[model samples]
Target: MTLKLSLSLSISLVLVVLFSIDTARAGYMEVTLLGTGTPKPSIDRFGPSTLIEANGRYFIFDSGRGVSIRLQQAGVALSKIENIFLTHLHSDHISGLSDLWLTSWIWQRQHPLQLTGPVGTLALSQHLELAHQADFSYRTKNTSLNSNFFPILAKEIVSEGIIYQHNGIKITAFLVNHYPVEPAYGYRIDSGEQSIVISGDTSFSENLIKHAKGADLLIHEVAAANSELLAGNPRLQKVISYHTTPKQAGKIFTATEPKAAVFNHVLLFGISERAVLEATRESFNGDVRMGHDLMKIGVGNELIFY
Candidate 1:
């Protein structure tokens, strides 16, 4: 009887452990850094794009260069991604928008792509549609794709508020300081008990700090250049002025205190990744990581990066 009781206790403990593991794997939001580069273009870092997968829905933020290729590499079908959120309308940020939109329609997307962004988004969409009219006409006439799926449904954000709420997931857009490119924005996504903040491209905006607080993960942009180089080049200085330095990003990370912070849309001019990390470390003593293309992070009971 004693041996049987001991065996039963062992089995119960094993089941509990298995149950805990399953629980940890379930309902966790997945974030994939599709392209972590800027406008200049690098084979290593394609462009600025992030993929969020939660509740069986796919949300893409910022369709930059090589977005379609990155999505293919990530094993996500173009048709499966229907919602896209744009932070701002910079050339580097929207360069891949037409490709993703057109390719998805060709690849059998049954509905129009739901696009959300700042005030100029609608105009951009209209122009893209006009530009692609010949392609859409040819495909619909020669192929099986429905012309109905060729349109892009765009929502232009005019203010800072909750922009999307569906199936227990809420996305909020807030203003960030990316001026002379006025009306720049950042985004906060919350689903279940997990949250993520994406700072599109900004230079230390207090509004971002307010929305990023207590998020599970914060993906922010950073620009790094040697001070000596900037001293001689006015153009470089102006470019750096529009973005957050590693040190400034560190301050924001410290203020928000997210569980983990990551740097994406990296703009490193004359410095190395080590230099950027060290500069950020000076202000933030939290878990901070440099983002790379195709890097996957799963946020749940604990943060998992693979």
Candidate 2:
């Protein structure tokens, strides 16, 4: 081969390699908080839901109230989502599944939705399908809906470990202490370049601390401070027992040492935002912020908030 031709080919190969590196760098791992509230409904906050976008793929952490609406607001198409990971079967956490399922199918989403979570997830999916049997039957007969697409793929998480792996994306589910719920979970998503941890409604969990250590971002559930008003309330105590306070969450953040920590599923019934922030800052000196509905955060070399 001529030296001139060899030189030209080498230059072209170098350009291609540079272009690939630039493209990968331009891609971002974005996390959008679709709902940041709990069971107690609020006008501003919906329910506990989050969307993680990595490598052009989207994964939903939980399908909470108004998730479909918030997802649209975030510029995400319902058809693009194929799987949903539920921490537990709490009414508030899975409330928006019906809306997401029905709306996507109506809009001609051809892929079967995959729901992954603890043991009872399959049962939950079956029950929802039964409840919508009449609608499914009518839609199948009257419309061009494919009956094959009606069945949802339910993956029941039987043990603690890596539950999902596709391409370079790996999702690990670890047991959390949302006791009486048996097998509640917190998930860690590692997409080669970025890592995110979502604490799905748990108390101070050592397992979470182990998994979340040095994550790019950690989104943990936090409850309102136990103040004088809630001091004697048995119901309030029960709620607090099953969840983590901002102070406790802060300590966990300190231990885990993430690049940034977000307090989500905020149960601020009476306490002010100032109180929550102060409590979290008392222990954790890292970059910490409270989560709000529709808040967008990107994890890359540095944390970006949108």
Candidate 3:
């Protein structure tokens, strides 16, 4: 009887351990900073792009320059990604769209690439189709690729609300102030008990704070320049006017109180990453990390960055 009881206790402990591991795995939402640079070309940092994996599905936030290469570096199969959400119609954010769309189709994407963005998204997709007409025809006529997958299905977000929900993953689009770029947006993604917020090129938006509250991870943009350069250059001043300064981002981070805060789309004209972090620490006391290309973060019961 003593031996039997010991055996039963061992089996029970093993079952509990397996259950705990499964629960932790199920609650995780994986995020990868595919590219962490702005319009300025950098060998270390590519253009702005992010990949979010939840419920075994892949979603890309922006298709910036070198996004395909970044995705390859992240070991994400191009053919597996079907949905892309654009923050705005900025050239740097959409320049790699053609490459991603065309290459994914060639790589055996089974469906039309689903693109969700602001008002001009459909028009952009239409123009892209027209521009790539010859290539599409050549591939379909000569290769085994299906012509049906040549077109891109784009949905333009007209208002702020829950834009996508599938397999327990929910994505919400909220308006952000990136004026005079009207209808710009930030996105909040929720899966199980884990949440992530991406602040898409905004300048201290209260709406972003509202949406980002208590999130597992908050990825935001930060821009900084040398004080003398900023004072002398009207162009730099105008550029900074549309973007969130590190200090301003710190305020937002403090208000949102996320489990982890990261800076992406880093645009430091003459300052260093340490300077940005120092400025942000002025207002926020929490841990802040400077996002690097291909950095992976997992949101679960505990925030994990790798």
**Candidate 3, superposed: residue stretches over 4 Å from native:** 1-17
lDDT of 2 at 154: 96
**Model 1 bad stretches (over 4 Å):** 1-27
What is the lDDT, from 0 to 100, of the residue 133 in candidate 2?
98
* Local distance difference test scores for all models: 0.93, 0.89, 0.93
Q: Once superposed on the true structure, which residue ranges of model 2 sit more than 4 Å away at CA?
A: 1-27
- Per-residue lDDT of candidate 3, residues 108-155 (tens digit): 999889999999999999999999999998999899998888899999
My TM-score estimates for the predictions, one after another, are 0.92, 0.93, 0.95
Stretch of 10 with least lDDT, candidate 2: 19-28
For TM-score, candidate 2 versus 3, the one ahead is 3
User: Per-residue alpha-carbon lDDT of model 2 for 77-183, expressed as tens digits?
Assistant: 99888889999999999999999988988878879999999999999999999999999999998999878778889999999999989867899999999987879
Model 3 TM-score, all chains together: 0.95
Q: After the best TM-score superposition of candidate 1, give how far the Cα of residue 231 lies from its true spot, in angstroms.
A: 1.1
Per-residue lDDT tens digits for candidate 1, residues 196-292, read 9999999989999999999989999999899899899999999999999999989999999999999999999889998999999999999999999
